[model samples]
Target chain A: MALRFALLAALYEEPLTGYDLTLKFKTRLANVWNASHQQIYKELGKLHEEGLVSVEDIPQQGKPDKRLYRINETGEAALSDWVNTAHNRPPTRDPLLVKLFAGGLLDRDKLAHELADTRQIWREQLAYYRSVEAQYFTSRAEMPAHFRFQHLALRRGILGMESNLQWLGEVEAMLADLAAGV
Target chain B: MALRFALLAALYEEPLTGYDLTLKFKTRLANVWNASHQQIYKELGKLHEEGLVSVEDIPQQGKPDKRLYRINETGEAALSDWVNTAHNRPPTRDPLLVKLFAGGLLDRDKLAHELADTRQIWREQLAYYRSVEAQYFTSRAEMPAHFRFQHLALRRGILGMESNLQWLGEVEAMLADLAAGV
Candidate 1:
């Protein structure tokens, strides 16, 4: 459901080929959402069938043709309705949280190691987000409207990672106390 | 899938009737995941058929029989494998971020309204989590091992909600700036 809106949003920006839209998911939209290139290509077809998105094919010399997608007016109205509607957040499919919930069934030390590994992963993620912020947002006050919103999404990701790291540290401290029989 | 894992984890804790499992999902696991009462009953039946869970019909006086479920050895081993394996985090399906991504197609004021509504929702969620933490964790140092892990999960929810609220504030400020045509 949201994937359809995501495709509509990307095509709203500009006319882009299927390959280009997939790249945006990998690079630009990685912060807020993650859709595999395969998934993007599949959903684009569905959206086209539903008349929310229109595709135009361009013939290439000595190459396969490229199909570019753009959102139609109906798609714009749909996207607007989705943006305004307040609903429950998406379902929770977080493995890490489930692991923590079931941690008593795991070896304490092994669980701690896993927690540390997860923290390390987030550390790298935070670094990556920080570098992105530093590179593109040095002069955010003058940033165009679309980029400004993009920066907001990135900022959300950074704050989320930071909060996760903080929670990991606190949990690790508890694990130490448990080991000490405190 | 992860929902199966969640069910196994709950059954691992203790043998409970399907109703009890659904209630626990609504309360204890609300922070981490959610499952409807009907879904819970359906999955419990599947788990029993697969031999991952065993059911005992306990007779109740002047009441309906209760089908209590417990994890079998196979289920325990399956859950252990799931807890130990490090895998990809679930896809990020944040609607607010999607809205921000499509802000260009939306009216600025309506976007701001939606943002405020989202922040209000999170504010309520944060309050709920804080109350839960306060009710359950009075003396952390002497807590049981399992409860400690549960506490860690609750803390994760609290921190995540806090981060979300902060991000909402920041984005709202950005929206203000956008309105000022800055």
Candidate 2:
């Protein structure tokens, strides 16, 4: 259901074909609400069925016509209503945390290796988010309302990755000390 | 599948009745991996069928028998194998982020209010984690290997909540400034 609103929000920005919408969702919104390409296409079909979005077929010279999706008035109203609705924070479910909780049952070296691997992954994510910040959120004060909100959302991603990285570092250090018999 | 391992980990600490296991899961493991009582009971049945866990029935004087679940050797081996397996970081999905992404469609004050509400929730969580810390993790240096791992797990929860609170504060301030025409 939230994916419905997220798709509407993406369409609210501008109309795109199913292909373009999936690309845009991956680039911008996947960090917040992860959805597959199939999900996006399926939801687009539903939104059209519900009369919340309209589709237009643009003929191609040598290929199948592309279906362009546009947000209708009903879609706009739904998106607006959803934006105002209160939302609760969802549950946290991290496999790494589970492993850490049971770490004593396994070798400390193995756990440390997992931590290192996770740290590397988060570092790469932080770098990607930083590139996004540099590309789009460089001038916050001059950004329009929509861009400002995008900036805020991006900041959340960046902060979350940074926090994970920091916690992984501290955990790694503590494991090292414990291994040293200190 | 991960929930299976989480349950095995919890039982590795001590044999617990179904009701007692559910309570312990809510108090300790829910932060890392949330599961419903029904799911836990269902998984326990499966684990027992698979010979990963053994269930013992202790008869009470005036009540029904209490079924206590203990991790079997097979369960220990399975959990150890899982702990050694390489796991990827999961994708994030925050409804608040989606709303913030489309926040320009709604009133800024509403977004701010949501941020405030989320901040309060995280603040309360941080306080709760702190209390857990004080109760169990007060002497990190003297903690055994298992306790040290538990401490590390708790630290991840604490750090995650604190980071969320900090990000919410920054986002709220940014929204205030944007509303003030700054």
Once fitted onto the true fold, the runs of candidate 2 whose alpha carbons sit more than 4 angstroms away are: A60-65, B59-65
What tens-digit string does per-residue lDDT give for candidate 1 at A1-182?
88888888888888888899888887667776778878888999998898988889999999889998889988889998887776567665577778878877767767777787888888998888889999997773587888888888889889988998999899989888888888
Pull out the clashing pairs in model 2. Answer: none
Encode model 2's per-residue lDDT on B1-182: one tens digit a residue: 79899888888889988788788777787578877789888999999999999999999988778989999999999999998887877777788888878767877777767777887888887888899999888964577778878888888888888888888877878878887887
lDDT by residue (B46-106, candidate 1, tens digit) is: 9899999999999999989999999999999989988877766666777778888887766
Q: List, residue by residue over A122-163, the lDDT tens digit for candidate 2.
A: 888788889999988896457787887888888888888888
TM-score of each: 0.90, 0.93
Q: Please state what fraction of the native interface contacts candidate 1 reproduces.
A: 0.69
DockQ of 2: 0.73
Scanning candidate 1 chain A in windows of ten residues, the lowest lDDT window is A84-93
